[model samples]
Target: MTRRTSTSIGFVAVLLWALLALFTVGTAPVPPFLLNALTFALGGALGVSWVTATGGWHKLHAVPLRVYLFGTIGLFGYHALYFSALRLAPPAEASLIAYLWPLLIVLFSGLLPGERLGPLHILGACIAFSGAALIVAPGPDGFTGGIGLILAGLCALTWSGYSVLSRRLGAIPTESVAVFCLATAVLSLPAHLIFETTYWPAAPAGWLAIVGLGLGPVGLAFYVWDIGMKNGDIQLLGASSYAAPLFSTLILIVAGLADPRPSLLLAAALIAGGAGLAALGSARAQRRLIK
Candidate 1:
């Protein structure tokens, strides 16, 4: 594929990632551990089944055990820290802080062999983060300082670290994501059994939420993101990623899951502008490199 086409596809795929917020709907009715476990379990099963039926199941065995180990630790750690923080802090606050991974990814990309750390990337990250902060800024009773904040920071770290490593390991079969998800399910099952009550989604809405989470955000998004980050323009993807939270908030408001807040408009401007600036800067740099 042409570089331009690939970049456009990656950009669109990452934007669609905003659908990930659908995972939030499931969280209201399901315990975090159970929600995570079930989502991964069901989704992973489908992935495995598809690969097997298509004669690609050997691809799973071909993946290095180390990737499985790292994927488990990284993804599970992200889930544990991020969800636990939600219980301790306001969900908005926790989410805002945790979503810092995009900026972190931009910064971390510099460490990868071919990725360059440009000033525009840094500036755009700051602007995007400012917007994120504005949107999740606390109401009168929302901000409680403690472990939640620390956990949120760690969540960002683990994810940023994971993304970089995933890119470096991009040679691994994409089917490895199924194994990664299954590992998460197996690891999370004990926590679900011990600390949480296991109950399936009962109402139609609840069931819908769970199934949606399993199929979309928690499942397929991972596959798309893996390839996008590995081959697409990393800085552009990082800058554009700010849109995920924005998209989530807008969708929530539209769905009546969240009340509308005035800050969203300003947040939209800052994030969109930052993403645009970063993307433009990257394009100019590529043109210069070609020249």
Candidate 2:
């Protein structure tokens, strides 16, 4: 595929993750470990099947050990901390904090060779942070869980580090996602056995959410995201990623899991506007450089 096409597909891939968060809302009855175990396990199976069908299985063994190791750390670490945070903090607040990874990406990307942090990038990131803060800041009832907030921050740090590393490792064939997913499953399963009770989702909706998470976010989403962060307009992706939380929060409201509030609308506007300005600036800079 052309670079543009690949990058466009990557944007779609990131957007799919928003849906993953949405589905998790419906699967609340499933314990965090069990929920993650099922999602990653099924997702691993699908990734393997896809790789096998595509004739990439032969190359899997050739993937560097570091790739597998780092992928496992990045993928497993983010979810583990994120899920744990959800149990302790309000999901909405926890998610807003976890979503800090995107802005972190914007800030961290500048440290990479050849990436620039222009005025618009900084402005956009600040705006997005403000929007998230607005969502996360407690109303009359202040946030009670300090540990949860810390976990969420760690989740952001872990995820941002992963994203930057993914760009460096983007040269690895995307099929290696099969390896990553399987590793996550192998790791998570034991954790579930050791610390958490293993139970399957009993309700149809819960099962559907698990299947959706496996297929979309945990499975194919990673495949697309790997390609995108490696080759796509990553700055644009990072700037736009602020929308994921907005979308997730909106989905929770629609699902009746979260109460509707004015902050939601304001947060959406700030995030959307900031992302728009950043993306527009990036496009302009690209045009100027091309000229």
Best by lDDT: 2
lDDT of 1 by residue, 1-291 (tens): 455554455556455546544455545656778777877887788778767878887777778789899988886788777767765654554565676777788788888887787778778877877876774566576645467767877888998889877888867876787888899999998988899876666677777777776777677667667667777777667766766666766665676655566665576567666766676667777777889
What are the runs in model 2 whose C-alpha is more than 4 Å off? 144-146
Listed in order, each prediction's TM-score against the native is 0.86, 0.92
Query: What overall lDDT, based on C-alpha atoms, would model 1 receive against the true structure?
Result: 0.71
List per-prediction Cα lDDT, in the order shown: 0.71, 0.78
Q: Model 2: what TM-score?
A: 0.92
What alpha-carbon RMSD in Å does predicted model 1 have with respect to the real structure? 2.7
